[model samples]
Target: MRAKAVRMYGTRDLRLEEFELPEIRDDEILAKIYSDSICMSTYKLVEQGKKHKRAPQNMDTHPVIVGHEFAGVIVKVGKKWQDQFQPGMRFAQQPALNYKGSLASPGYSYEWYGGDTTYCIFPHETMELGALMPFDGDSFYKASLGEPMSCCIGGYHAMYHTNKQNYDHEMGTKRGGNILIAGGCGPMGLGSVSYGLVCDYHPRRIVVTDVDDAKIERAKEVVSPEYAAEHGVELIYANTAKMDDPRQGLMDLTQGHGYDDVFVMVPIPSVCQLAGSVLAFDGCLNFFSGPTDKNFSASMNMYDLHYTSTHLMGTTGGNNDDLIEANQLAASGRLDPSVMITHVGGIDSIAETTLNLPKIKGGKKLAYTQFDMPMTAIEDFAKLGKSDPFFAKLDQCCRDHKGLWNPEAERMLFEHKGVKVEV
Candidate 1:
């Protein structure tokens, strides 16, 4: 089959190209990708390219496709997978295959198996490892956002607090405890907030901190304070950009008790240090962000770690179980991952959009693979509507969902006018 995809040839070299995919083997499955969410980690992969161990070393031999957060439909199932996955079934992936202790993953490691393409083949290893998960959901974006959401869920599970009695550790975030999310205005930050509130984390108070007030407002629009209150969760937003000490406000919010669970959303050392500083007794800090710097280190108060029993940990990506949980939550309407999307576009613009993702403001950039339209921000939908009625409908749909995209909008979009592609 002929398909369009974004390929990374080398460092700072991402190109959109046409390619042919071979027939699926007996142990393989073919998927037609429809929605892919752009991630900041892709930016690091683009800049680092072959220098990164996760990416293919020889670009000429393997011009890798560049995206991981994606969702699609199963177009063709191999002989082995026919009973498990059928044609026209929706699907998403865990992506962090980590096959046999190798550094390779689908988006960064594979030449023909990334999310940027219209169609991709799932190799035997992926099937064996159980990374490709089938989902039943209304919005494809929800499936695409599943991987990142699972990352948040995984981090919460990775966190552990030491028991004063047994001296052992208890895993997972504390229920009915005060939670803090540092740099909680970005896409993942927003996801962490929504998931922490909705799922079983059950935080008594959830505090989100960011430098940009506008971003904090945007975050509120996604997960309103009133909505949090309705869920029996106290959601607090703080701007630490102007404060002399960012941790002071966090401590104040908890009445100088400090946070029971701290999730560091930013990769900077200072932000990690700040997250650690605001830890309450028996607090567990989960460093959620992955940094490019090899020597990135944050100072830790060893005395606090030993006496107060606070500890820190980090995870690169979620396992298969976490992805399944994310999908289940989205399907059940308990979790709305679409709040993470800021801009929507077509496959034609994804190459440039992904290359310059760091410069682009707002949250996740979502792509409708068959659509040919230029990138449009959700905030600019009203303006775009004046020029085109299609965008006007999209504007209403997004507005109906409180300035965020949803399954109804997705169906209405394709039913009204989407770039039709017959695979």
Candidate 2:
């Protein structure tokens, strides 16, 4: 069968091309992708291409598809998996396969398997390793957001603190302790704050710092201080750019005691240094940002590291269990990841939006694989609606939902611009 997808042929070489897919083997499954939200990691993938660890070395020949945070419906279940997954069932992918310590992963390693594609083949390993997960969410976009939300869950789980009794590391963040998400107003940063409110172990306070005022303001609207208070957590959005001494200002919010857990959201060395400076006794500084530079270094306070027992940590893509937890959070209405997505597009918008993801000023750029429309931000819906009726309807849906993307907006998008399959 033929399907359209954005494939990486080489470094910064992404093409939205229609290609043929091989017949699904008895051990494999065929699926139709609906929603895929672009991630920063995917932008890094395009920049490095075959040089990326998860990407195969021969991308010039065997091109790989370029998205992982995706959700879809099972179009045809393979004979071997009939009892497990059936056609028309919703599914979400946990792309960090990490099979047997191999670097192979979907989006970067496979030719006919990725989120950008209208259709894809799930290899046997996706099921064998239980990475292909059932998504019981209201919309396919939420299912796509699950992949990144799971990443946030994994970061939360990966944090470790100094166990005073044994002095051994205790996994997970400190409960009822002050928390900080530096450079956190971005997509994932917003998610980290939202999760902090409803996480099993609640924090006393969550201080989010970002350099951009617009982003900080937008984040507040999504997870406001009032909303956080209802969950018994004090949330503060601080724009460090406005502060003369951001480090001092941030420390003041914690009453000079510092934070128990600090998650660094940006790859900037200064942001990382700032996060390190605000660590309290036995604080766990999570290096959540993935820098492209191999020699990226930051100066941390070594005195506190030695005497305060403050430590650093880092984690990559999430595991299948994290994905499951993320799904549960979304299902139970505990984690609304809508703050992560900013723009919506169609399959035709994949290549450009992905190739220049960093240039696109937004959180997650969601694309519905079956549609044909330009990439448009939710904020611009009203602007575009002034001239176009299709956008006018989509604008109303978003306006009704507090200018955020929701299932109704997705439904109206489909109703206005029905499926357009060239193949």
Candidate 3:
């Protein structure tokens, strides 16, 4: 059997190619992928090429499929797995695989199933134990969002302030506690927003900061007023580039104090510095995004950290339990991650999409192997040059606030077309 997949040949080089299906082992299950979402990590890997040491040995040698977040229907289950999995059942698979005695899967590797393909053969180890969730949901797109949401759940489990008195009470008062999500416009940031809204120790106010106007607009749209009212949380969009002091904006929002919980969704050096600087006394700063280069470093006041009793931690990938909880969250309509999905294309579009990832903005891009849509290569889209109205406005905003717009801020402003001028 031949299946379609986006095969990466080298750094910044990928192609949609056909490959013969491998024979299914006795305990394996074959799934027909319905939807797969692009991951920022994938983009980074393609850019690094051979420098990405974690790429599977054989995968680096041969053309490899390049996606990890996806959902599908179990089409064929091998003999021993047939009873547990049935044909035509909606499901999502956890792509992480850990051959290392450790419990979690490596963040970058092809042994881990890649979702950017037509069909997938899930090994029993992951399918039986990881974040694979059963979904009888409306669409494959919705089911496909499970992996990303599960990653958010994992982040929540790893560091979120729980309602348990031991946790919240020890930190501080829970009622008026504030949570700040920096770089809150990307897919992971949006996931954090959804999870933060539903947390038991829900912050009195959830401050979402992003330089992108479009992302802020979309964030506002997804976090409807009704949801905000019921949850007792207020979503604030801040243009980091415009604010004289980004940390000051957060402090003012929390009434001169900083946030009790701060999640840094982007691993940019400046964002890390901001997170470390603004975290409240006894606050917890969770770094959700993994840093790309080893040279990247952020400056912080060690004395402040020592005196405040604050905690700083980082987590990657999630466990099966997180995926299960994510599935429940979506099924109950408490969190609709599908709102973050904006574009969907077939396997043929993966190469182009990956290449243009840095330029695309607003929402998550999805790739599907089984369905074909009016797909256009992102490269074909005309670049919004400096002469464009939005670009001009963005440049002016950055120029006016010279100190505020860091590299991350500049990228967000460009990607989201968010330029706020005084009326």
Candidate 4:
């Protein structure tokens, strides 16, 4: 069998090519991918080329598929997996495979499997041990959101400093009493917003700060005003590029005490420093975005941390259990992950679409296994210079409904138009 895939030949060099599919081993299951979302790190790896240790090491590389977040249906299963996963069963998989003696799974490493292809072969360990989640929902796109949502779960876990006996026992809230999400316009940031709303701690207020005006506007447009009003969540749109003291604005927002939980979704060193500056007593700052270079460092007051009891931790990827919980969250209808999807295209556009990740805004970029839409087509829809019919309708919907959409209505629209309403 032949399948379409995006092969990373080297840094900044990716090609859409056809590759022979490996025969399903007795312990392997074959999946037909329906939707895969472009990750920020995928863009980073493509641009960084050989500098990315996670990329294949040589030209003889196996033309590894380059995606981690996706949802698919079981197309074929080996004898061993036949009893478990049947053909046509919809599912989402955590692409991390841990063949190493260590328990940790192979996430973006050379030994791991990726989802940015038309089909994939996954091992029994991944399929049976909760790495692959069965989709009970109507849309594959919503299931595709599991990977990022799991990462958000990991970030929240990292942000909680359980060692603080007093706060953990008395206040019952994790490390930071209140949570602050910086650079909240991105998909990861939005994931944080969704998770924050449902977290056990239930911070007094969830503050989302962003630099992009358009994204800020969109955030306000997508996040339900009723949810915000009920949860006491506030969206702060600030110009970080021109601000002399971004920390000052954060401090002011927090009533000068600072936030108990802060997730720095942006990799900028300044954003890290700003997170550190706005931490409340015994607060924990989780660097949600992995720094691109080892040289990247942020400054903070050691005295403040020692006296105020603050912690700084960072995490990457997520465990299989996290993905299961993420899928459950989305399927519950409490959170609409589809609203986060902004672009959709096929493997042919992966190269150029990934190259422009830094410039793309608003929501997640989805790569479809069946569509042939080009990068330009999506850009044209987004760049109608504010006159785009979609944007106009979206704005009207937001205005009339106060930034929330009826998922059922949206589903009807997509289904009526045969637009593949996943999520």
Candidate 5:
């Protein structure tokens, strides 16, 4: 089958090209991608290319596809997996296939298997390892956000508290304790806050800090104070840039007990350091950011680390279990992953949008893989309304959600744009 995909050939060489796919083996399944949420990690992969550890050494022989956070429909089920998954079934996956400790994954390591493409291949290991997940969600984009949401979930799970006496470490943060999310206005940071509020993470108090006041305001809107109060969570948003002493402000919120769990979202050494300094007794600091620097290091107070039982931990990608949990939470209306998305476009916009993701602020940039549309921010719908009728309806939908993208907006977008939804 011939398909179009954004492929990484070398460092800083991501090209949207047409390519032919090989016949699906009896042990493989073929799927048609519907939606993919562009992640910052994808930007990293695009810049690093062959230099990326998971990427093949020789791009001349092994070009790779460029997305992982995606949802699709099974177009052709393999004979061997006929009883398990059928054609037309909706599917998503945990692309972190840490198979026997191998560094390879679908979006980064495979040539014909990735989310950016119109079609993708699911190998036997993908199904055997149970990474391929079938979801019953209202929006394909919401299902696609599951991968990134699972990554946030995995970070919470990976945090461990140390026993000062025996030095034994226990996984997970303190239940019903205070948690601080540094740079909480970003997409992944918002995901962490949403999961903490909805899931069993049981955060009694959650403090979200960001340097950008506008982002903090939007974050507040996404996870409102009323919603947090209903869940018995004291949610606080702080513009750290305005504070003379950010640490003092955070301490005052926690009554000097400090945060029990600190999630560092920004990939800056200084932000990681700041997050570490605000840890309480037996606190676990989660380094959730992926740094581009190979030798990234942050100064830590070793004395406080040993006496206060504060430790730091990090994880790259989530396992299959996390993906399942994320999908279930989103599908059951427990987790609204749509809050993390700010812009919507089609496959045509992926290349430019991905290349300039850091510059494009607000939240996750979503792509309709089958459609041919320009990148459109929810905020721009009002301006676009005067020119296009479809955008006029989209502007109203955005207004209905207080300038946010909702399932209703996604459905209306397809309807007005004359795009068919494959069930």
Candidate 6:
């Protein structure tokens, strides 16, 4: 079948093109992608193309599709998995298919298996490794957001605190413990806050620090302090960018006791240092950022590491179980990952939106593969609605739901007059 896809040709080079897909093998599955969440990792991959661990070297010759956090319906089922996954069933993708410990993942490694496309094939390896999850969520956006949510869940699960007496490591964040998310208020950080609020491991206090006050305000508005109180969690959004001593100010939030779990959300040396310096005894630090640089390093308090039993670890993506939990939480309405979406676009916007992702403000830039709309911020919907009836309806849907992108808005997007997109 022929499909339109955003293909990465080289570093900083992406193009939207229509191409024919080879017939699926007996063990592979074919799917039609609907919604794909633009990720920072895709930005890094595009910036470092061949040098990226997951990017193939010969991109000029064999361009790979450029997305991962995506969801849609199954179009064709392979012979082997007919009983498990049927055509017309909804599904979400876990891109980190660590098959045989290879760095190759979907969105970064595949030619026709990524999410930024109208149609793609799921390799037999995907089925064998269980990276393709079948979900019946309310909207495709929720399933797309699940992939990023699972990343946060993995970081949460990887958090470990050591026993002072036995020196044993306990997995998962400490219940009723102080948690800090450094460089938070971004997309993944918002996911962290959402998961922390809903997860069984209740944090006594969750402090989020970001450089941008606007982003902090937006985070507070979406995941409000009032909502946190309802969940028996103290949520605080702090602007540490202007602070002379960020570590001290962050520690002061915990009453100088420091935090039990510190999550580094951004790939900056200063944030890493800040996250490390404010850890309490037996504190677990999970570096959640994936930097493009090979030798990225940051100074840390070694005394705390050696004597204070401070644990440090990093997770790139989540496992199948983590994805399952994210889907379950989202499906049950305990977690609303839509707060991460700030912009909406179509297949035409993938290349430009992805290339300038860092410069673009706000959270996840979601794209519908079959649409032909420009990248427009959700916040701009009301302003755009003044002239266009389409934006007016979408804006109303968002306003009805506390200015959030919901399933109703997603349905309205497709039903909008004269906005039909075709490849």
Residues 219-309, candidate 3: write the lDDT tens digits.
7766654577678778776778788888787688888888878888887888889888888777778888887686766777788777776
Cα lDDT tens digits for candidate 6, 373-402? 899999899999999988998998999998
**Tens digits of lDDT, candidate 4, 54-155:** 654663364456777878788888998777778888898776555454332322443224567777777667766667768887667778788888888877
293, model 1: CA deviation in Å? 1.9
Candidate 5 TM-score versus the reference: 0.97
Residue range 112-158, candidate 1, lDDT tens digits: 89898888888888888888878888778899999999998898888
* lDDT string, candidate 2, 357-418, tens digits: 88889788999998777898999988888998878888888777667898878877776776
- lDDT per residue as tens, model 5, 1-423: 989998888877888888899999999999999889998988888888778888888775778888999888999988999999998899888888878888788888988888998888988888888888799988898889999999999988898776657867777767888999898889898998888887776879989998887888888888888888998888999888888898888888999999889998888878888888899999988888889888989998899887877877887678888888999998998888978988999988999998898898779999988777888888888898899887898889778876778889888877766777665
Q: Estimate every model's Cα lDDT from 0 to 1.
A: 0.86, 0.88, 0.68, 0.69, 0.86, 0.90
Every model's TM-score: 0.96, 0.97, 0.81, 0.84, 0.97, 0.97
Q: Candidate 4 at 263: error in angstroms?
A: 0.7
Error of 3 at 45 (Å): 1.7
Q: Which residue pairs show backbone clashes in model 4?
A: 11-49, 176-260, 177-260
* Model 5 lDDT-worst window of ten: 414-423
- Runs with alpha carbons beyond 4 Å of true place in candidate 5: 162-168
**Residue-level error in angstroms, candidate 6, position 19:** 0.8
Best by lDDT: 6
Model 2 lowest lDDT segment of ten: 414-423
Q: Model 3 — which ten-residue stretch has the worst lDDT?
A: 401-410
Query: What's the CA error at residue 296 for candidate 5, in Å?
Result: 1.2
Name model 6 segments beyond 4 Å from true: 242-244, 417-423
Runs in model 1 with CA error above 4 Å? 416-423
